[model samples]
Target: MDFRDHLRKIIHVDMDAFYASVEQLDDPSLKGKALAVGGSSKRGVVAAASYEARKYGVKSAMSGRQAARLCPHLIFVRPRFERYKEISQQIRKIFFEYTDLVEPLSLDEAYLDVTVNKFNFPSATILAREIREKIKAKTGLNASAGISINKFIAKVASDINKPNGQKTIPPEDVIDFLEQLDIRKFYGVGKVTQDKMYRLGIFTGADLKLKTLDYLQEHFGKSGLHYYNVVRGIHLSEVKTTRIRKSLGAERTFSENISSEIYMLEKLEDIAEEVERRLKNSRVAGKTITLKLKYSDFSVQTRSKTLKLFIASKALIMEETKALLYQEPIKDSIRLLGISLSNLNTEQPKSVKKPSIPKEEQLKLPF
Candidate 1:
C-alpha cells in the first residue's frame, strides 16, 4: 500500500461573519440587521459584512459608499481587532485541549491536526461536533468546521455548512467528493485561472483529472503539479504549530496630501520608526527595505533595496527608506507613506526543505 494513502485527519474551523457577528452579540440591538464592520468614509472598504447585509449583495472589501447604496439601512461599525484577538485566543485554548497542532489562518479561522488528538476520539467527525459545541458555550459564537485528510479539502469543506455547521469528507469518499466538486471550488484557482480552465473545457474536478501531468505542466507551469495532486486528494502538507513572519511593515495615510519632498521625508521618518518598533517587538531583522508611496490620484509606487546583512534599527531603516525616496522624482502629491522589511533571518521548519524556491514562490499560507 502507498504510505500516502494513510494521511492524518485535519479540521478547518471558521467563525461565521466573525466581526459582524461579534458586533451583534455584544449589542443585541444590531442582531438580525444588516451590519458592516469597517470605516464608513469615502475611501473606506468593508472589512466584514453581516449575513443580513450579504443578502443585499453587500460584500467585504466593497466600498462603504457602494454598500450604503446597496442597503440603505446598513449599519456600519468600527472594527475592534483587540477584542477579536482576545476571543481568538480563547478559541485557541479550546483547540489546545484537543491538539497542539493548530495553524491559525486568522482571528476567525484555523486548521487543526486531530489525527493524534489528546481526547483520543475515534471519529474526527464526533470530535468536530464537540469542538463546535465547546466554542459556542465558551465564546457565545457560531463556528463552522470542515474535516478531511488534508488542509485544502478541510478548508473547502468548512464553507459547505457555514455559520454554525460542520462537514466531513472521509478518506474513502475523497475521490468522489472532489469529482463532483466544481473547478471553481479548487483552492488557489482564482477567477482568471477558472476562466482559462473553462475555456480549456476543465469545468470540474473530474475534468481536471482527465489531463496528463505533462500537459498541465506545459500550460500552467509549477502550479500544474499542485493541481494534479490536489485533484487526486493527495495534499501532503501538515498542520503547522508555529507560524513564521516573513515580513514586517507599517503605513500611514495623511490628512492632507504632501507636495514637498522635504515634508515627505519627514513623514517617511515616522513610518520607518513604526516599522522599526514592530521589528524589534518581533525580535527579527530583514535584508530588504521597501518604500511605498500612494499619490493623491490613488496610484501607488514602491521601491526596494536589499542589503548583504539583516537590519532592524530605526536609523538603518530610515536611512535605507530615505535613499529609496530620493531615487525618483515625486510625480504627484503623495497621500500615503510606508515602509516594509522582508528576507527575514528566520526559517520555518518544513517537512520537506525547499531552499532553492524563491521566497515569493512559497504559497502564502492565509494568516
Candidate 2:
C-alpha cells in the first residue's frame, strides 16, 4: 500500500498517573509528595502512586507494607471512585465535542480517529494540541496526546513525552520510528514476550520485520499475525465505538481469612458500590447478580439470583448482592468475595440495525 493511502489521523490520549494526579490536582498539599491511594493496612495494595513514590520504587498492585518498606514516608489515601468517575465523564464530553470516533481504552485513556473531525482542524497535530489544552483548561489536570498515521504509532508517541505533552509522527517517518524502538517498547510485546523474542534474536522492529509469517506463527500462534503486521506498520482495526459490557463484577482478596458475617457484609457493601458505579457508567441494566466466595483453602463457590426486572440503582444492587452473599452457608473462612452483574441489555438506540454494503462493491462506486 502507498504510504499516503494507508495514512490516517489517529490520536491516543492518556491521562498521567490518573488517580494519583486527580488527588494531587484537588489538593495542592499533596503535590510533589509521595502519595498512594488505597488501603494503608498490611493487606491493602496500592491502587495508584504518585511519581514521587515511583522514584522510591513504589508501584501499583504492591502491598501497602511493601510500598512502605520501599518509601517509608509514603502517604496512603483511600480511593474515591465516584469522584474519579465524575472527572472521567467531564473529559469524555470534551472528546465528543471534537470527534464521534472516540474509543475509550479505560476511564483515563482513549484512541480517537480524527481523520475527519467536527472542528475542521487543518492538521491532526494541531487538533491534538487543542484537545490537550482544553482538557487542562477545563479539568485542571494534565493529559498527554500523540498524533500519528495509525493507532500503534500514536500510542507509542503519546508516552514518549508524558505529563501534559503532545507528539506527532508523519506517515513518512513510520519506518524510521519503528526501526530504532526497543523490542520491549513494541506495542503488545510485554516483558515475557520480549525476553522470548530476545532469545530468538528478535531484538528490534527491524529484526521483527525480517521474520517470515510462517516462522512467527510457528512460535507465537495467533499473536504472530499481530506481530507480523505491526512490524510492517499495517493496522486495519477500526476505532470501535459500540462496546457492550459482557460482565460487571468486583472482587477483593482479603489479607487474612475472615469467618465473621458482619465483617463480610461490610466488605460486600464496598463491592456492591463498585458494581453499581460500573453499571451506571456503562448505562447498563442487568438482570443477574452473582456472589462468589473463595475459601481459605483456595476452594471457591458461587450463588446467583436472576431478578425479574433489570436494575441499576445502588441500593437495589447492594440489597441483592447482600442477599446472595448470605444465601449459602460459609463452610470455612472466606479469603475472597466477589459480585458480578451480567445478562446485559445491548438494545441501545444506536445499536439498531442498518443496511450494509460490501466493501468491494462500495469501493467500485465514486463520490
Candidate 3:
C-alpha cells in the first residue's frame, strides 16, 4: 500500500478553561485572577476554575469550601448554563464551516476527521491553525488544537501546547513520540491503573510496548488490545455520526412503600431532578416520559406520555412525568417508583455538497 494513501489526518480541538474563560472574556476585571464558577454553598462543587485558580490548587469537582481553603483569594461565581449553552452552539457552528466529520466529546472538546475538507488544504497542520485563528477572532477566546495521523495522537498533541496553541505530529515521528510518553498520559490509564502498571514495571510507553500481547491481555483484559494498538500508532475507530444509547430509565425505589398522595409527590420530585440532569449532560432531549411502579408483592406496571416536542429541562420533565405517574391506580402499597425518558435526539450530520471536480483532476488522487 502507498504510505500516504493508507494514512489518515485527524484533528482535536479543546477550549481552555471553557466556562471560566468565558467569564473572564466578558469581564476584563476577572482576567489574571483566581476565579471559579459554581455555587459557593457548602453542598456545592466547583464546575469550572481559571488557570490562575489552578495554580492555587483549586480544581473542578472539589467542594466549594475546599477550593476556598486552597485559594484564600478565590473568587466564586454562579454558573450561567444558559450563556454557556449559547457559546457552545457558536463554537459548533465554526466546526461545521470546515468539515462535516465533527464528533463532539463535550461542550469544550471535539474531534474532526479532516482527511478530506472543503478548503482543499494540503496540510492538516495549516487547517488546524486556521480553525484556531477563526475561533479566536470570532469569540475573543483562546483554543488549543492538535493535528496527527489518528485521533489518539491528535487528542494528546492538542494538550502538548495549551492555552492558545497548536501542535502537529507527522506520521514519521509517531513512534518516537509514543515511546517517551509516560504511562499515566495514555488515554485510558487512570490513577488506579497507573499504580498497577508501576508495580508491574510499566512506567512508559516503551515499557508497555515491550510486554507480550498475551501478558497484557492476561493482566488488563480487553483494554490490553486498545493499549497495544495505540502505542503502535494504529487505530481503526471511526468517527461515528450516531451511537446507540445504553439505557433509558427513571425510578423511585422508596425506603418504604406508602400509599399517601403527599408522600408519593415528594418521591417523584427527587426522581425528576435526576432524570433532568442525565438528559442535559448527555445533550439529549426526549419526546417520551415513562413512569414505572412496583407493588409490595413485586408486580410491576408502567405508563408513558409522548409529547409533540422534545423536552430537556427539569421543570418540564417533572410536570410530564408526574402527570404520567398519577394516571395509574395506586391500590396496593408501592415498593418502587421510576421515570424514564426515551426517543432521544442524537443529532445527525447534514449532507455536504461536494465541489465539482474536473475529469483530469478526478483521475489523479486528491492526496
Candidate 4:
C-alpha cells in the first residue's frame, strides 16, 4: 500500500504506568498504593511511579529523596527488566497477530500501522479496541490506544484517555486538534524547548502555526521545520518494522559527590566492566567510547574518542577511559559517571543523542 494511504490507519499503544503497574500486578497487595519503582536510596531515581504517587508529584526521573519528600508514605520497589521483557514479548505477540507494521518506541509503547490488518477490519478504531482488550485479558494489565491519521497525532492522542481507554482523531479533526494542543503537550517539546517557545510567544499549536518555516529553522535548527509541519498535520513518517540499537550505556549517581580523581578511577573501572558485559551480550563492538560525567551542580561533561578498530574487552575499554579521564583536569566534584559504546558493527547504526525529524520523503501533506 502507498505510504500516504498507510498514514491514515496508525495506532499508538501505550501501557499504563508500565513498570509500577507490573510490580503491582505481580504483588496485588501493593495495588492501590502510591508506589515508586526503583531504589529507595538517596541517589536513586524513580524509574516509574504509580498513578497514586503521581497525584503526590512523585514521578519518574525524580530523585528518590525528592520523591520521599513529596510523599512520605511512598513505597519503593526494585525493577525487574527480564520479567518486564517477558511480558512485553507476550504483548507484542498479540500485536503481530494483527499487523507486522509495528514500531516499538519502548517496551511499553509502540506505533502500529493497521492500514491492512490480518482480520481485514475496516475501522482502525475497532481494531485498536480489540488489541487493548486482548492485552488486558492476556496480561491482566491495562493498555491505552490512540487512533489517528498519522503517527505523531496518534502518539499525542494516546495520552488523552489513558489507562485502559482509547481516543481516535479522524482525518477531518486532525487540523483543529493540532491547533488546540498546548505547546507543552506537542509531544516533541521538552522543557528546554518549551521555555524557548514561551519566549517566542508560541503558547499553543495555533501560536506555533503563525511562525514562518524559515523563522523556526533559524531558532530551533532543523527541529523548527518539524514544529511547522506537525502543527499543520503534515508528519510523513511511517512505522518501521525493526528498530536498531544505537548505543549501549549505563550510568550511576553516587550517594555523595566525590572530588578525588583516585576515587573516580575506581568508579570508572566498575562502569567499564558493565559496558563490556553489555557489549558481549549484544554481540557487537564499537570504536567510539564516550565517558560522561555529571558534576555536583548537575552540569554534565562528556569526552569521546573513536579508535582505529572496534574493541569490546573490559581491559581495552578501561585503558581508553583512563587516558580520557586524565586527558583533561576535572575542575569540579562529580555526582554521576557513565560509559557508552557507539559506532557499532551493526551496519550503519545511528546514535540516539538527539531527536531529529525522520528522513522519509517529505511533501506538502494536505490537512
Query: Which is the leading candidate under TM-score?
Result: 4
**Sort by TM-score, top down from the best:** 4, 1, 2, 3
Give per-candidate clash totals. 0, 0, 5, 0
Which of candidates 1 and 2 is the stronger one according to lDDT?
1
In terms of TM-score, which candidate is stronger, 2 or 4? 4
Writing each residue's lDDT as its tens digit, candidate 4 over 62-132 gives 88889999999999998999999999999999999998888899989999887667887768888999999
Off by over 4 Å in 2: 1-4, 253-256, 259-335, 341-367
* Best candidate (score: lDDT): 4
Tell me each candidate's TM-score.
Answer: 0.88, 0.77, 0.72, 0.90
Question: How does candidate 1 fare on TM-score?
Answer: 0.88
Name the lDDT value of residue 201 in candidate 4.
Answer: 98
Candidate 3, TM-score vs. the true structure? 0.72
Q: Who is ahead in TM-score, 1 or 4? A: 4
**Colliding pairs, model 3:** 250-338, 250-339, 251-338, 251-339, 252-337
How many pairs of residues in model 4 come into backbone collision?
A: 0
Which residue segments of model 3 deviate by more than 4 Å? 1-6, 243-367
The local distance difference test score of model 3 is 0.80
Model 4 local distance difference test score: 0.87
RMSD of each: 6.4, 5.9, 8.4, 5.2
Q: Please give, for residues 253-329, the per-residue lDDT of candidate 1 as tens digits.
A: 67667899899888878888898888989999999999998898778899999999999998999889878988988
* Global lDDT of each candidate: 0.86, 0.83, 0.80, 0.87
| Pairs that collide, model 2 | none
